[model samples]
Target: MELFIRPNTNEINQVEIENETGTSDPVVVSINRILQQPDSSYFLEGIIYKVPEPLRSMNSEAYTPTAISIGPLHSGRKDLKANSLKPIYLRHFLNLAQLSVNTIVETVQTLEQRARYCYTEFIEMSRDEFVELLVFDACFVVMHLTSWQYPNLDTPNAVNLWQSWNEISHDLMLLENQLPFFLLQSLYDLFAPSQPLLEHQSFIQIVQYYFSEHKNPKLFFIDIKPLSVDDVKHFVDLVRMPNTRMYSHEKSDQRLLWPLNATELHECGVIFRSGDGIEFNDQGGCLQLPPIKIYDDFEKRVRNLIAYEQCHIGNELRNRVSNFAVFMQCLVQSDQDVKLLIEGGIIENYLGGINEITQLFNNLGKHIFIGINYYNSDCKKMKDYCMRRHHRWMTSLRRNYFSTPWLCASSIAAILLLALTLIQTILAVFTGFKERS
Candidate 1:
């Protein structure tokens, strides 16, 4: 029997619909939308970024500003009590500079688009809101920096303001809580010419002086000749300058394999000395590293710095802070390693226990890719130096026998007794031989 073949209704309807209207497929439309979007270079223009999930999840509080928010990322938070001081500081800045509010507003408005481009996220605030925020935040930052010199005695509690300043300093250094350095410079330049205190000082110099005195004392030792204000991205980058300048970029294909912990390296006759950067002397079996000061906020600062490097720095060779973190992680495996580094003066432990220090290093370098480690060659040299059997034996001997004065004296006495016993045996043998003759 011949059956009438029925056409597939859905396919026929789809074909008819396509023919009736000039419409692209859903996927084609999506592809076109994607093609119209900007490239990676557009995103690369952004200096400010939200700390990625892999890092943020590790320590949320480290990346989050506790005291205040600088830029749009953490703006309008009710919990941040320092947000209330922004308007007050803005008024103080205007009064000090003898400039009208419209002057700074116009200045910020002119650079609004440029400032917005600095952030990776799409800022939800309107042009007016964003501009006002910048003016208030920028003024607050300048006043905050010089707050130590110009204490606000008008406030009922001067002591509380001082405490808030310390907290705010840390908050300003956070990766997310940052304004563009150029915007800050522009604002500072407007009033700087008139102020006697800021007459000779550039914004960069002021920043250098403030951070050096308060945040990082080691900044005084770092040669900032290679750094310029134009090169600095933000406060996080400013903090990173000393580290980036500490080491020259060297590429290596080798990875650090079998990295002995600090205590193990010490046992293998490898000496660790605190210095400006990571270096290894094969001849002397010495490893020199800058002394890492572990304070309460040290991990927070380091995490933010690492997060900045991860987001901004494309080249691993230039990821000095991240590379250092990786290197430290390799050297610190346990509390013993931390103690050894502490005893050797390689690490200054201000956070109380060695376990915390150990955990600090161990927690770093997670969920990050380390390419072209700066200390690879030095690590290899150290590992090779440690491989020698003689060095290990000598180190063992010295550590075991000469570790204490009593042990050293006992070792000497034992050696002398063995020598005397051998000499007495020889003398008796000679006498017996002579008597036989």
Candidate 2:
């Protein structure tokens, strides 16, 4: 076991504790206990993390949880207004589960160390405090998700509790403010044990509904496809799960460069139609994008998911959310590109003006590391289409002759003038031949 000593922290005079068998100084005993733990279960890496500085600095507000916090990272902020309500929710859940708060806390205490290991850093809270936090947070998730399951039924506290649903939803999806999925599931099962609240209620359905706008044929890129909840790590991971479910491109490994941006691609005869029913295909580079509305909150949600992927060692193919962000960034360099996408119905800009939407996507991939785009084959295919001689010739003709109104008018006038001259010459020749006769 390794001991990390900070430069200016309390100094240690000796390596080994003087009383090897007996109880030594309190600090020494703590250090010795930590060192004696097995090496195989030392540190669990990449489940959760503080956002990197560059990303955090871009828009610190996006990373901050506004209404509620789930885990230790943002648990006890004084500014959060929802902290007082946490115990109420916990008590409500306890009543539903038919268990006392003490019983639930003790149950959670059993999983304390295991749950602590799920985090990237060491948690500093005592055992009782950790158990309390877990019980409270886990209960919050269960109650929220369960309540959302019955959307049609009006709840008593709906208006007062979730007046700013958007704010709380965005905060929940943040990378750092997440509890492990298993904890939430255990609590949920206990709360809903043998009591079917609805005929076909599911945890996944509740989550999808919570995040979904639920418009017919949802105007956003929500994966309605049923996903196994077992594989999910947290809320951010669950939200991004759909994007990464794309079939592995046959040439996904190939370093296929992203094709030309929107205008250039259009010039090359590559059409950008809205993908109303776009399916995830293994064939890369075919630009099939689900229509998405770019609202003010869009950047916050997307950035959090990307930040989560950036922090973890994740599958390249499964990191489709990050890949999509990078892909969109490559396509949109300016307001004009955003305009093009808007025209194609690929992006519904509800964020008011085009510039804000443009800036949102442009800044998304900054300082983010990405591998070969999952759409490599599609890019290659587009490039090949662009390189076609006929397409190239057509593009040139459009650029040169038919580009402007004046050019079109001048070409038409020249053709008309040539026709007139030829007719006159023919008539003169015929008249001269007749005179000779």
Candidate 3:
């Protein structure tokens, strides 16, 4: 009954619209293309990194360079105020190295690729630009460090430069703002004094000398050992390495911790005392802490060191400073804790209030990727003390009865009154029994 229309032979063919599963999305295609591309090769892993967002957000000022830019990451930051000084310092270095501009440029050009390889990411600059930044930054850093070590031989400009050292030092320790250690060393050796004032002193020693001035001078300068160049990656690393040995390497159980804050520990009858050494030790749970002078820019230095450790992809850096940061974060959880530490001379709170110190520590080590628990034994000791029945009883007695003179007097009066009532009741019962008999 169906009528089929066998119409004209030139009828257009019916086209069906359907979803095409085979067609690739532009994003997918691009990603696949990138995946198919050959991996970029470098002789060395990049040691520097732009501090990630989580850490930067916590304290934006800590990661931002305030005075100068040392390397490519922050090289052309618009806000950098020390650009004018770089060329001046470079000129001084040229005078010291005794190498012509063309010669220094050529030497750096040769090592340009290797130096680039030291960075973790591909630098977005031309070959000329990259080489220029490396040569300029390296020379500036080397010259700056050298001038400090040989102050007697310093130029007028060098002496003036020292005036801005507080800012310069902060800039140098930044995670993103760093040059390769070898590059600086090579530059240093090329221009080292004909008759060196310090024969065995290397660039690391010079750096240690400059940066360590803000730290406990007794610990930083006394019998300070020279660091080998092979393991160090940059100036920030050089700064971090000296304090790595501060802590003992003893093992501790994580679960067995004296996790009490300072006030609580004090309440638990634990004494807070200053540590013997002039620096904080990360040894397994040993409660030794060096006196910390919390200057205005202290957090910036500590944050940058931790960020560098987090960015660097190996145990070569050992993550000791970041570990110390984590340990401190764990140690100071409240304002009361800061007060206890201050009383103990373990923390010199120059930044003013207890809350400021608390926030400073709490904000640190958030991006600490490496896991190191150095205070396990110290925590365990405190935990054990807290768990003891004798300590608990004493603490309860002191808190309940001996807290103040008024409370003590009230408690004594109540006890005496109770005794008198019991005596009267016993006498009345005995008298009643005799009358009944």
Candidate 4:
């Protein structure tokens, strides 16, 4: 058992509390009694009584960290001082802790070793950085908690490693589920209880930290397929951003990770091609990072983007039928994200309300939508697009209408001239006798 004394002010003398454990009874009782303070007064700096034997015993069974709790300080350091504190000001810190049971705060980090990426860095990090990284890494943890089939074996750091992984998984589930209400409120509710080791601990601070000062290197992944390294070089050449760093030959102990937050922001997947020459079909790098600190901005942006994306596809489908089918069919080529969204019921909402679609034909007799003027009207766009695309497949719905014949204005004028010429010949024949007389 170790007694770590903390002081209120810089004066080490006023913060002093001495340990006086008696030679009688067991060491555990003496350790606990001395920690209760001879003086009934509260000190901002807590003093502890050290006991080697029993102190190690209780903690060994739990495998949890030695709990250090922040005790009675009534003021928000910036708002209320010792003399100026009201009754409400006193319990603020405890209230704050109760609010923060589940939230995590950490900063942005690039991809590195998974254990080293999350574990070693989590320990070395400032409290703000730790929480920020924890927020996104939590998402990854939730995504793959049950699958501990990798390097997380029984090492000395196994306990800490599992705890980190478990907590991260728990936190991700929390964030995803609570996005509807005040995100900051949800953050405070989860993170309040954690002992404040670093200054930036709030959920808002975690987000602000990302966009303000956090940035990682650029990243792009490719599964080594039939595509040559020279092809990569050529592709990079077309992306002609001179300052953009390119590294084809970089290798790592774990997975390939760039030290940039790009992995944290984008939705990622692996790309591959199948052939006899292929050694591994599953190739390409994963962007392994968490979401950004966009706060409510994230939700708003997502809502707008999804809504716009759905409408854009609808419009394009309305304009071109075969193109739209080709698009859906082409998605079958690599149907991971797209298929998931479809299965998740995101697409059904768009086209389900309409009965059928309208179609137009191109000069080449290619089927398309005659919907250039349709936009100004209040029509169901998504269903319109889907039906127009599906119209050719429905052979039973054929009908011939009184359609217009192809005729130019000049052709109409020529027919009128022919009628006038016959009229003139008849009129001349009737007037023939009068002209001879």
TM-score of each: 0.87, 0.81, 0.76, 0.17
The C-alpha stretches of model 4 lying farther than 4 A from their native spots are 1-176, 179-198, 201-437
Query: Cα lDDT for residue 340, model 1?
Result: 81
Choose 2 or 4, whichever is better by lDDT: 2
How high is the lDDT of residue 207 in model 2? 73
- Ranked by lDDT, the better of candidates 1 and 3 is 1
User: Could you tell which candidate, 1 or 2, scores higher by TM-score?
Assistant: 1
Candidate 1 structure quality by residue, lDDT tens digits, 33-59:
444444542355688988999999988
lDDT against the true structure, each candidate: 0.76, 0.70, 0.69, 0.26
Candidate 1 global lDDT: 0.76
Q: Tell me the tens digit of each residue's lDDT in model 3 across 1-437.
A: 11112121121211111122233464544444334333442323557677878888888888878888888887787777776677887887777657799988888888887777677656777788888998888888887777766876466755455467778877787888888888887877777754367467767777777876665443223234666888778866766664434555564445523266666666766655565442322222234566777878788877877777776664643566776777678778899889878888888877888799998887675767645555566565667666666766776787898789999999899889999999999999999999999
Question: What tens-digit string does per-residue lDDT give for candidate 2 at 1-437?
Answer: 23332122222422344357465676776676556654534244337777888889889988998888879998889888876667777767766567887778777977776677667765777767888899888887777767765643334576686577666667787888988877776676666664566446667667777777422124323655786766767777777765322433543676757757777776765556676533323223246666777766778888888888777774543455677777788888888888877877888877788888878888887888876576776777777777777776776777777779999888789889999999999999999999999
lDDT score, candidate 3 = 0.69
Evaluate residue 198 in candidate 1 and report its C-alpha lDDT on the 0 to 100 scale: 65
The candidate scoring highest on lDDT is 1
Top-TM-score structure, candidate number:
1
